[model samples]
Target chain A: MKVTKKTKVIRSPKRGFYDKETIYKILDNHFICQIAFVYEGYPVIIPTIYGRDNNNLYIHGATVSRMLLELEKGVPLSINITQTDGIVLARSAFHHSLNYQSVTIFGEATLVTSENERYKALKIISDQIIPFRWEEVRLPSKKELKATKILKIPIVEASAKIRKEPPSDEKEDYNLSIWAGEIPITSTIQNPISDPKLKEGIPIPESVKKLMKKE
Target chain B: MKVTKKTKVIRSPKRGFYDKETIYKILDNHFICQIAFVYEGYPVIIPTIYGRDNNNLYIHGATVSRMLLELEKGVPLSINITQTDGIVLARSAFHHSLNYQSVTIFGEATLVTSENERYKALKIISDQIIPFRWEEVRLPSKKELKATKILKIPIVEASAKIRKEPPSDEKEDYNLSIWAGEIPITSTIQNPISDPKLKEGIPIPESVKKLMKKE
Candidate 1:
């Protein structure tokens, strides 16, 4: 999809691109996102977990979710996901910036009503956080399903802004006697703590063991 | 400062805190934030870096920043900062969630015009990314300072929402044959990668060296 005026990057047009492939890559790499919507005439930003399946993005919460209630009114919403790759330290304070990849997805969200679809949407969300963990876990009960709400927003319009290179200092500032470089940053999964109320003989799942090794 | 109705955490009131100390700790620990505003009648979210100084929060960008321009007009804005602490893997998909700490501040913003204040704000912003790097880097030139816009938003109405516990699955599901626990997550400062065009003999600063050892 082309970059719509609504989704265009105005501050740094040179850093913007509207390719869905690039957008998906960034979205798949990050599971948490912030959603923007109007609440009582005030713009509000809320942090929540998300899952991307093909062209649609899913976010779930309790049926009493204020975000779900406000968003399902057919109002416009913007979802933002960002990952910091490195810290770019410039020779001048004015030129310091972060090397990051971010995606802004725009769409109107609709509530998923069908029981089958809600289960699928949540399974996608569960697996998004930890691959194959859903298979080992018990499924939701009927009352639990009734209390959960899943909303789907199609990727109708989206754009990505990326900055991967080192800082670009002035020609003269480069000669200054200062250390300038990027301190690489990445998120890692740390040690897992077993639940205090665990049953008698439940071992950590294989899925979690794999994440430990990978991390 | 007390959290007003504007910043109330309605969804999970038990996890909400309005105390300034808790809010400031969350803000100081995380540097990146997402700002929410209305553009062309549609809600928009943009990710940006921020700094916290006492009871005020600061964000800077190019003078041409649409977010800064719109915010300077005294429009309503929502600034959100979040840190993912762990992942709550529940025995049932419906109860799966993340352990995170997030703060949301709501207020009108004003542009910082004085040179002294702008320099201070940028210095605070720079230090927020990496301590002591600003002192080593050259100060911003007159033109560089002129091209940048810094906005200050008071922490008048703010709240921190946090969840750092293990999964709370259904009572019956706890006895089921599934793994349930908390997988920790944290951001570690990696080794600094010297800029390819760095001068010959600029040793890594003590600031970066400390971070390397600590991480």
Candidate 2:
């Protein structure tokens, strides 16, 4: 990953990471991302699902979606994926902070035009959400595929910013008789709730079972 | 909560909401937000913590932070807050989706100048993270307050988009022998870990105790 002027972590340079391994590790942990693009000379942001392959990130939307339409024009795109790990409590409010891992990517996205590549991108996206479920579910038909538009953004310029340690307070402030600690935050998958219209005899599949076990 | 052209939910119009009660309910649940601003004709996004009052949202950073500096110039700012409730599983890959609640605010922010208002905004932000924490910890001093910059954006042209129901698949696809359900996702606060350098006799504060009980 090339750390261009835009991708460099100007503030708190110590927390910035410009390697592909760190960037991909953070991106692979979360499926949802907030994408920012220029529309009508104003910046617009939208939250959507994304999947990252080797060097490219894929996002899909309906053919008539405004975000996809604007992004397909090869406009500059900024994608952010963040995960809040914990809340850092300090003896002083000025020193409080959060332990989070975030990656920001600055690049342009082009519409995926090839049929074979589109299918591959869609599969990568599905696998990001739930692995091994694509083989169990009914694949998208030609008409369905045509209704969806997929865009690929190369991860050429990106950087990850992370803070994982405890709170750092001023030297004398720590002596104050104030309670200070860390509250860990976690997002876990609960038990699956079956669909109301599900068939009576169908059991939970292996993919979900594996997810439950892993979580 | 006016539905201007910029705030209108173009795609999936049925999921769009234009009410204060609904939008605030979602905003009050999360403390992190993604903010987008145009820089040198390109959109840049940064993830930061935010707090919301009745009709305004407040975000703070170092006085010299790039995001705060750029936003204080009275440029257009876009803020997005999203919470993923669950993953909607369907019998077909085309119908898979996520149950999420998201709000997008389009407005401009001004640097909060008044000392009292700045203190109030900092208290609100600290409350958003942990209730009653502002009273327990050492309040920001005058010099510390001067080092921080707070910006407030009115929630006038904001809209919330939500999807909370089960998967809606094709009529014929539901009959297939495939598992379909919702995997609920939850962000919970675990037990608090005491600071390594904490005072020997200081017990956990009421704020953290209450947060643990509530969560």
Candidate 3:
């Protein structure tokens, strides 16, 4: 929620910024996060799917998740998310970089305990992967709820860094006449090949069908 | 270089001990990392390129990198790298998951100072994009070096979480008629399109040319 720090890199300074709108933009686009926390004396990092609801971020895994168990104990945690836009091929090695937007939220995450919030958190996390599928599928039973743990971390201490544009080079290098620019890259889903054993004549849902039209 | 206290995560009672070698394999294949750290009073995260050398991980950005600067100060830092292999579609929402291999490293980073080590770090970071290009291109000049800051954080505290194969469903759900399985995914680069203004007859380098042949 606060923008206390930002960076200025010469080759890609324009790409770095500290703003809520920019941070939210990047967070909304990515569905996964790498959660880092110290376990014992060493740093432990884990990747998990995450859902952002208002100011709080929710992440969950099996009740037996080692990282989650340690994290649930109120260990300090850092969660990071990123989206790659393209590859920048500068005229020089030093000038080369990737066009990306990333947000990092740092804080100690508490294990969610309220039963109502826990179920809601699970619903939000599931809906993130496939909207409305939660309603279509049978809800979790009491045992299932007890077997899963969801951790909620507030976005109170978060910042965003972004980079976009053609490469930056010294004037002298630019004059040397080497080609330089960005090769835009994107995460594109190919045609959805249905499961071999999919139900006969079951039309692809809108969510699965959505990926097919994207270039 | 030791996988000491600062780099260890709780050994999960279940789904643990896939081995460090297997974890490293996943880390090596990933091209991006989301790093989380505290900046001032807030937590900020960013995504950037990273390379591993022995036990240390090297990352670089502008000399004024905020996260890097905060990280260089030995503050707690969390990093996560993930490779998405496929999408798991199941008969029920609770059983749905992803086929992925991800590693999260948590710990404070130490800035690289030795000229020799920095040189090697730069090479590793660059080679991740194209292996031989480090030799093909010019190295950073003294001024460039002065303008850049590189940090080496040992991958001591780390853990890899992975899920493979079809969905896991309750015994009862298996009997209920519904579809279940994985939808594989991968990142592919299309044929390289040369810059429109590329000078006549500058044969594409072997590295660039070779990428074209990959599907």
Candidate 4:
């Protein structure tokens, strides 16, 4: 929403906005985020799983992870989440692009310290992938809870950019006979493959099965 | 790949790496990159389409773009491309992860100078999505070509880290009988939908059709 000296900071420049609904929709659709920050004066981008509860995003990492550890110390960071839906082929190569919905959140992460809040944040993170999985699985132990670091980033300044329609070409180039359109792309999750060492008689939970039917 | 204390930084201690093959594979599978840079002391992250040729990556923007114009002036920047393949669920919620490939290329970008190299880079950028379409479509005209700026960043001091398999949980936790495995995910291109303004007889070229059959 705020334009600085950087413009590429705005993806889908022709169609970009900071609407709350648009930002939430993009965030809910994607679960993975690439968090970028400066490490030792050089840039480092880390891919990690994140869950949003209310306006706060909870990202978890190992207790000793340099990224999470540094984040706990309160450094400014930029997190990006993108979901590609298709390939857009325009008549001109310059106009070619991707049909995608992405959200970029820039904020400083505050470490979650309260025991109760951290526990609920972890549950939210787990339920993000499958809502019912939280109850189906055993809760985390106190020691395990103490070992994990979950950081919360408030979604204050965020934006979404998307391209959904077909290609746009000059009228003169329309008759050139070049193919132009969109190749619909989708991210599909296959049936959950149980681990080889899984215990017998553990029926396939509905939480896990629901993902297979997602389009 | 050299892991400079400044440029090639590792964030995820548990998963980060500076491997050459991993970096190339991550870069090869993706074309769009989210370039992050500090503009006027504030963070800005923008997503844009990009192409890689040899050691340099070519990214273009409008001639009047403030961000791209600043980039052409050798502004410090961080470019990242990530392709998420699947979600990894573990017996323990803390251990949940994602199966993904990403590349973070950091350095000052130099504006491409030679006209021939710019044209060729444009073609490489075009061929990235569809190989045959570059030659099939009309090339950029002199005026259009001159109006765009292409910045190239050498592929140096880059690293890629991946988590591909099922989660590695404690031996005792595995015996707790929770469903744990990878939910395989894939980005597949479906049938192409032609633009409404296209000529009636324009057949879908093989280059466009090839995406649907890609594995």
Tens digit per residue, CA lDDT, model 1, A1-215:
67788888877788898988899999888789999998888899998888899999999888898889988777999999999999998888888888999999889999898888888998888878888888887778888888888899999999999999988999999889989899999898888888888886888899899878877
Instruction: List, residue by residue over B112-205, the lDDT tens digit for candidate 2.
Output: 9998899999999999989999999888988898899999998879999999998899999988999898999999999999899998999999
| Per-candidate interface DockQ score | 0.86, 0.91, 0.32, 0.57
Return the top candidate by DockQ. Answer: 2
Using all chains and alpha carbons, the TM-scores for the candidates as numbered come to 0.97, 0.99, 0.80, 0.92
* C-alpha lDDT of candidate 4 relative to the true structure: 0.75
Give the better candidate number (1 or 3) by lDDT.
1
lDDT of 2: 0.93
Q: Sort the candidates on lDDT, descending order.
A: 2, 1, 4, 3
Instruction: State the displacement of the C-alpha of residue A146, model 4, in Å, after optimal TM-score superposition.
Output: 1.3
Model 3 CAPRI rating: acceptable
Off by over 4 Å in 1: none
- Model 3 Cα lDDT, one tens digit per residue, B1-215: 24444434454324433366876787777667877665444344567788877667899877886667778889877777788777777767777788777676766789999998888889999877656556655468998888888998887667666666667677677655555566567766544444454445555565554544543
Ranking by DockQ: 2, 1, 4, 3
Model 4 agreement with the true structure over A1-215: per-residue lDDT tens digits: 55433323443367776677778888888777778776555456666778889888999876877888888877878888877788888777767777888887878899898988888888888877667777766677777787888899987667777767788776788777777888887777777777667788777777778766655
TM-score of chain B of each: 0.95, 0.98, 0.88, 0.93
**Cα error, candidate 2, residue B132 (Å):** 0.2
Measured with C-alpha atoms, the lDDT of residue B104 in candidate 3 is 67
Off by over 4 Å in 4: A1-14, B6-19
What would the DockQ be for model 3? 0.32
Q: How well does model 1 score by local distance difference test?
A: 0.87
